[model samples]
Target chain A: MFCFIALLVFSVLGIFSATHRKFAKEAFDCVFRRITFRPCNTGFREKVRGIILVKLMKRSSFFAKVFNKYFELIAWIFFVLMIVSTFYVGRGAYNFYLYGNCNGVNEEGFCLFDPTGENNKISPVAPTCGLDTPTVDDLSLANTDLDKFFFIDNNSEDTVVFIGCYVCDFTRKAFPDIEKLLEKKKPNFYFGHLPVKHGSDFISSYDYCAREDTSGDYWKFVELMFTSDIENINDQNYLQEVVDKAGYDKSKIDECLADPETLASIEQNIFNIGNTNIYGTPLVFVNNKAIVGPKPYRVYKGFLK
Target chain B: MNIKKLRKDFYFLQKKNYIYFDNACNSLRPDCVVEKINEYYKEYPVCAGRSNYALAEKLTTDLLGVRKNIAKFISAKEDEIIFTKNTTESINLLANSLDLKEGDIVLTTDKEHNSNLIPWIKLKSKGVIHKTINSNPDNTFNIERLSKVLCPEVKLLALGMSSNLDGVSIPAKEIIDLAHKNGSLVLLDAAQSAISEKIDVKYLDVDFLAFSGHKILGPSGTGVLFGKKDLLEKLGSFLVGGSTVHSSSYDDFELADIPERFEAGLQNFSGILGLGEAIKYLEKIGLKNIQKQKLVLNEYLSNELLKIDKLHIIGPEEASRRSGIVSFYIDDIDSHQLSIMLDRSAGIMTRSGQHCVHSWFKSREVASSLRVSMSFYNTLDEVKKFVDELNNIIKILR
Candidate 1:
């Protein structure tokens, strides 16, 4: 009972000491000092100390749990954020849908009624095709958008070919010849050619494709014009290694690389035969649209109307 | 508790959608702000200066008015406030303006955001010595300990009004008064406190206060520096540009007067106009009322969160004295995973990791923490929902 009484007496005295500066300067200093400053760190002590220790200690489950705890906190925050954001977006969408999206385009073209907005009454974009496929009629239909490209075969009965620098070697060789033949067969053949290289003294054959975005890299195409090891360019394994390291998927694109003969023929046609708009070697163009040397003739040829 | 108003006010941010909780980082733009920007571009669109046209004059006047508004917000003379890009710029301006001798010491705390810490750290590296005081692991400010460290050499006592990490309020006024008694200058980083705290530079006798605009519902790329007129006049201007020159010759040039001298070049004009609007909006609501609502939310979150097992809140438990920030951690989750999961699954947003208060977190024996900060715009349903999500996350995340 005396001990309890003594404790109460000390507590009162302690409170007094804490309040009065003259009586308890040192005590105040101690509390004040305690309120400020974290203790010093050793050389090994870090702000994010023990973060890697879990991995170093091979405590996978422990690390996962620890990691998850922080993420869980983030999750709650995200949930709140998403709830707000979705509402915001949906409201905006709803307002636009109901009030009519007048931010330049008519309401009929937007995906307001269609999935991914693909079935709108407005212009449709041509579907991206594999390297060898030539479908000009599909590419330039009223169903597809042509304004964004350099060339359009809209309402034309011809096929469209997309020209790429890296496809098949055989197709590259035979493309130029086919392009000239196609142009002869149909004087009004329409095609699209991408100047992957901005400018490197090429002869112009005819009308070029309409442009969307302006060229930002003038030196990029010409930079690859002369190659020290052309074989390495076609090596799928070497390319795959690069793509893999860069985190790109190569497994899904086996067919594009498998047809080397087609690639070679296309290469030969472009560099050797049809309207040689490019200097004295591998050149390819469908009537008016063309690029010089080893370009994807199949794509360009497919675009003839 | 008022979901109706919150949902309407923040109608721009409703859910299954990503709600960004990182207001301290950058608040999501309100539609009022977005439309203001659009109106500026589509309607009264004109460059501020460099033209004698009516739009130009209006833009110029609007720009200068924002500087005046910033001064009133922090309780300073119009000429004392200089528009800056953000808090880092304001602190940098102060750091550069000061004369740092080889032996002079700058006193600061471990709770400093790197914006406040690095300028002095760099000064220390350049021969000016620095002394650091610390908060207890929980991050509270104590004045007596600071007085002990204020030797004759200590020239500046740099501090934050409220810590960015845990939102623990520092006794900024008391600390400033104490530092002045020691014949040291005090600089308050009001980045975390400005929106919530009612600052009276005259009552507190603080020499300088700095804050970012975005944290207060204003636009980014804009900030305010509030310095006493006398000190601003006494200090050297760090940025010298076309706008800051009073007169110039081939070899010699006269500098512009105080605030103009400090505000060197082209400013964020539209941002300033937006900041003025935000200030007016806050004024109509009143800081005290906002503080009250934020306090209730902070208390609700802290008390409810503490009941969960294995949870460690990083700072003070009381709601009245602290800023509306709660940083806590569960036993074993890597913070980034939770941040990502929070984004993908829960649709919530919170700041994770050390929050740039590296020294404080280290001293407190914390690896990393998750911070949930509240603004007046936030609703209690969001808080309850946050706590509920947190509970489920802690369960499965473990």
Candidate 2:
């Protein structure tokens, strides 16, 4: 929905290689030091030239007073700006805290105060306020006008899972067309490389289900896609289409699929939220506002001021 | 060594107004190298190996001639030399091709450039154990320290001919002999030292040597990998493509002979021709005389820098161990900031940061430093002017 073409600027040209915490600090430090260190440090003759000229003019006291006043004024200006900038950053962070959604999934595929179940009835779990994830029973009302089945990624913090494989069949990349597009849409996602532990079987693949899921707050999206098709698509419609086409045989995959591994992974993902001061999904923050995938250059430009 | 011509080249550099201290990074292509490339591009630019046409044959012959020239230059056979993109690729080729089994320990120094270090350490994930020998605080090699680290598990000892961070030339002859006595093959990264100094691989008895032509007044995108004939024969090719294979089918393939097997796809023909010209130029000037000039200029710079207060040189004071590079830094100012100031204000170029020897800098516990390197073309006047510039920059910085 965002400017897809314009965001390509960041995907292709931006310095993605520089992302680690240490390097990030070093980058800021490098910029700060560079700006602070230039200009006046030109030449020794240039250095003494002004001072000697001032002294020879018999206005050394006036020159010294001017220099002191100039420095003091500049110092106050930078200090005030820095304080304002810090408070602005603090406010943005406060908003992130207030708006963050770290609750259990609902039928709407979002964490709401009260969520609904398949029969349009209230959820059985009477969730507590702020303490536990809210259920459908706790709902004040339903906003049916909002797009149903739409993924409301209104939550600012999104997590991405990065998967890297060496001998991977990089062939099937274009097949997961929908997932690929989604991955492209939101660059601010996580896909922790599992090192190809999963095999092409239900059990082996589901083993990832049991693997410890860290947090529910961040967007648990996987950017890495492959062309391994589990279902035969005569019409070639992926996900629900593949299941819909399977008909009676869909039971083996869709209905009977209470995959222990998946449940385990959800448990794992949900288990450690807010534990060990774990900062949920990485924020691919551009100019402070949260954006996923490559937001159009205009989205980035809009926030600059 | 014809100081007048060298000065002319230096003036040619000054006319462009690029102080170009990135000599350690990669030296600028000399006029002769540029002409050699022009001759290849203008006269005979054709794809090699597949064709027996006149131009193709000339390209093939010229490329092979470069191989032979490089082999002769380093006392290697033409068949034992494999051309690659740069020093990193050359060492990576060696790393991938070498018969490294699990449990084989790679003995190397902490001061090694990443090009020599990464490829070997990468083998660690494949279950190969890597053991590092410590470099002295002054970036000098200690024979006893290396001897203690060399064990039966040490199948190979990789070394850099000169430390890129500090420009200290290793006692490779002695190091190679020590490794051989322990029954280990040695690979030397001569990317930094090869152009500035004489390299007699046979005399030094090095099992393998890799170098970049760009560092030696040649064009970029050309590197040479040389190994002992027997060792080269034993190693397998990592990359498989058009020229590298002898025979191929849908399912199976046979690799080509030694050097061809290693060199896959289209060759950088122009780069090699230019590299050959660079070698021809160096030979004309003579490595001994070139080495002498660089050392004189280096020593002058190092001595002058020593005169400045708070300016600490990174390497040893001993002239014999150090090459033409001098890495130094001062109090308060970061090396990155200093390098920028030097380039922007004085038009004096220099390299700063870790110099791709993070482990070396980390091991020494010194943060980061600025580097000013010299080649045969650099002179006493440049050194003096550099000192004057430093004095000015430092005064303002302080």
Candidate 3:
């Protein structure tokens, strides 16, 4: 009880010290008395202590005895704790005021140093792919038939292969950008459905839809799976609805789902993707240089140029 | 509890048909909370403190009324409650405002979330001492160790009321009593426990309490810091400027009273209004009922999860002790990969990672784990679906 009162009294005096020069001495005295296990000199602290003591006596003699025994010690501890917590809070607020995040980490956002840091904003400075050697022609696409993959456009000179799985949210969100890239540049963009078979069984259903949509309405199927809160993508009827919505020929989709060739092609894409050291989704390889996951439009423009 | 009726209140559950197990991260707002936020923008969009117009007066009254409701929720006076952007800021307010200097110490548990842990840990740079007591053998709070650490020298015990990682609730009342007895002030981080549990600050004799609104079906960027009025007044303002001062000259200024002294500039009026509505909704349901329902859901999830081979559940094995959360990791499968599989296969939303308690994870010698944290709106059917998906994921991935 003395501890709570001391903390309260010290706080008021501490605040008042800013305006009233005399209040600093009172604040110091309050803290000193509270810390050293001395009897609180102020009537406010004494009254609070007396009230708590009476309440303890009313409850039980044993309780009152225990309260009296630890009263000073408790007050000291409470006073010190309150003081430390106040400083700690002040420091954090200072950091937040200057750095945006409580800590100096710019990843959480709104940092004074980097205002656009949290958004993963595009850097105006041109970024290199950081590969030691340039190797676009070295990537063996001569043996592989491009038509077997979910080809968005096959006419452009520059090839931009988007290695992604439909089940992944990042990959699904990245499609609009990939679509824009294809429409603008007309790059030989192969929407490779690299269904990472090790992590998920549901990827197979997505792979099935990818293979079935030969007319390249595969993106429509991906959009349906991405947008709609469907539980099982592997459900044949549910996937068939996606295929129908994508405007794919019904019998062709069924034939593709049943075909061994479709599975072989998907396996080949995954195998190729794995060889490229692509462990995650929505990887765009523009002329064998990789740009991973939802980069801003300027990044693509930079690479395309 | 009438889950079917309660489920109707949450649009994401009813219309979207999502099995939301990510309540620990952020809860889906109910219709009333959304409506309250909308009302704030549509009805009175003016700043509460800066204006004296009729709409501004109404807005200010509504905001103040919300403040009263928040205080009532925690059994504190309105003046004691200070609004913050989130629990992180609330804790930071206490961290900055207090006059802790060299030789002072702040002791916390190993299982605290980053919000509670980081603020205190940062004080090490200022020459203030910071210490941590490890959890018990079963990963519960170690009372004996806490007692050993609690000396006259130790100033503060900053602890989470409940662990966000594995959902083990520490004995907060016992800890508070012990801290007061041993001369340490207590700060309870009620971020995870506030929504599901009943927390009366007066009953607990807690010196300080902080919690976020988003985890309680309210708007994002909303939080509360409850402090004893006297202690709050003592706290020096860290982020000052704007409406914090009453009157000012070129060099000198008088700060505002109690809560406003801490609140600084214009607040999140919309979010605060929404939080009030959210609290009203929770009160109608009763927090006791919410806690009871959570335990039932958690128990079913734990029992079903235990049957799976190669899967290890973290913290206490007892379902009741785990609160509304069940965190587990399989022997070889990556938790992030599993999270994706669960989402794609079952539409089950689960959080997977260090859970911002990286220190605890580092101590436990685990890399990552998947967590299914439920709220009252969750059903037995959802639990069954989650388990079935888990079983299927194990069968296929393994």
Candidate 4:
């Protein structure tokens, strides 16, 4: 009984080093008292011997004497089982803590995200163990044709959508440069925009680029838009100057711009880009895998594959 | 409910210096429980039910009385409850005994501790399909998602009554009612909930329940599994030998009635006896008072811990939603490494890791977290010291 209590104390408080060392000292003291009678009245071994004598005495005196001779060995077995079982239970608990399973086999594996079981059905790309999820869903504007908006080699077999705002200088320079380099290497390379901007200016810009530009000179039109004076972007007639310079029919461009569906499409594009879960501009994805913001040409070359 | 007074009963909590905040793992046992175990070994060391002696008869009667007390504690009949080694074994026994065949689905929450998750998951090899409904990001059970998965194919829904990761109680009664309407049985893993919250199995009409005694101030290697009486009769015994049967012939045998058929062989009689005393100790303190005191400590800890920078508390930020647990993570420091520092610096013992819910962590890509689980014996002073030490440790580690 005392051994059982000692095991319990050893299990609970022994997680701390100080308490563990104190228990070690107490255990040594207990063992010392069991072997030597110094500073002890009666030890656990003596009590077990007394109990064995009382039970054996009821049968025969000769058997009682014989059993009493090996009582210390019996006490050792009892104490060992108590200590071992306590540790066995502790080990089982530790296993349960680390692996959730008693055997510590984590074979059922982990669901990458959304243990709601909608992970696979939601997106095929969300389960990449070490990769960032390219989470463009059905609501994304990337599914729209680049030719319907601003075309930059829309006939290419491989396409990459670069989500950025023309107000940024990095997008003004990097978009065309990457498109030129990749287009020369593979004739079927396309760079498209799912445009984002800081304010309502994106609506007019997308309306001009998507609806007004019809001669396949949309790339030249966007280039003229980004390089022009920053304050003239919102002016309707000044925008017509940039649009006419890119060789668009001015009356046709105005008629195309009058449709509310053009502005609604741009608004939907901004909303779709916002829903992509990307925080920064100039974020590009080759197929569905995201490339970090505005990398060097050599780095983009590795990602183009 | 008075922490300072209740602290005196526990050998570990009586220490003025050490702070034990891992009660969700294993609670500190009271002196009465230890004394009861010692009394059992000293007075009647003989085995129960297999002997004709006076001590053996006394042992059998005392064991039965302990079962009766446990049944009363959980609002169950003595015949409906069966004792096992721990909650894991209890769940495993139910998983093995229940009549689940091929194409039969068992539903569980994604936030379940491994004890509840692994048992049902292991049944996939036996043609039982295991499906997990997504828990809310805060580790609370999402009833809407539970409703989505409670289809006709679902034979049983095993879930933790409260999350071990975050101490939020699941809406067990509502889930049971919904599952019953779907024609599915419900198994509540009350390992964390049974101690901190009230569990009236009868009122909830829970078909099955499993809980570990060690998590509720009782002895380790002690657990209880409760089932409806008719359901218990329908399920076969997972373990069969010795006391499981009342009579046997050469090739055939009749298993004993409800509870005895499940408790095979010689049981943990000493631990069960100690558990009976632990229940008595809890009842004396009033479980409602214990629950209320834990909430007070949790509210204090939550308010203070929220003030610290770089400390992110898991689960709902509101105190009303959480119970006696607060699992959080600090920036830059790994959870296991930080826990070692806490133990060495201030004698603060906390659990740090996935907390047996690796799937939950994996879903969020969160590797580990530091959990501080409280009990009724914890004090405001202790909580303050823990928070203060945590602030200091973050400073040094950062």
- TM-score to true structure, per model: 0.57, 0.60, 0.57, 0.57
Residue A232, model 1: Cα distance from true site in angstroms: 43
**Tens-digit per-residue lDDT, B1-398, candidate 2:** 77766656532574765566778998877787888899988998889889989999888888888888888888878888888899999999989999989999998888888999999999987789888888777768888999888888899999888888888877899999989999999999999988867888889999999999889888899999988888988997798898988899999998888888888888898998999998888888888887787789887888888888888888897554577788887766567656765666556788877888888777667677889888877767777777876665555545
RMSD of 1: 24.9
lDDT of 3 by residue, B138-250 (tens): 78999989988888878889998888898999999999999999878899999999998888999999999999999999899999999998888788898888878888999
- The weakest ten consecutive residues by lDDT in model 4 chain A span A117-126
lDDT for B222 in candidate 2 is 93
Alpha-carbon runs more than 4 Å astray in model 3:
A1-305
Residues B146-183, model 1: lDDT tens digits = 87788888889888888888777787777887888888
Q: lDDT tens string, model 2, A1-305?
A: 01111122223323554333333343344444456764222222222233332342244445544543364464456556656865665654443333322121212333232223221122122222567553333332122111111132423343222222211332122124324433445433233222222333333222232122222111222221233233331122343342332232333444334655454543343332222111212211332333222222333333333
What TM-scores result for chain A when each predicted structure is judged separately against the true chain A?
A: 0.19, 0.21, 0.47, 0.45
DockQ for model 1 equals 0.06
Candidate topping TM-score: 2
Error of 2 at A237 (Å): 78
**2 or 4, which is superior by DockQ?**
2
Residue-wise lDDT of candidate 4 within B291-359, one digit each (tens)? 787888889999998997777898999866778899988666567656765676678899988899989
Query: Pairing residues by index, what is the TM-score of model 2?
Result: 0.60
Error of 2 at B138 (Å): 2.2
The lDDT leader among the candidates is: 3
The worst-scoring run of ten residues by lDDT in candidate 4 chain B lies at B389-398
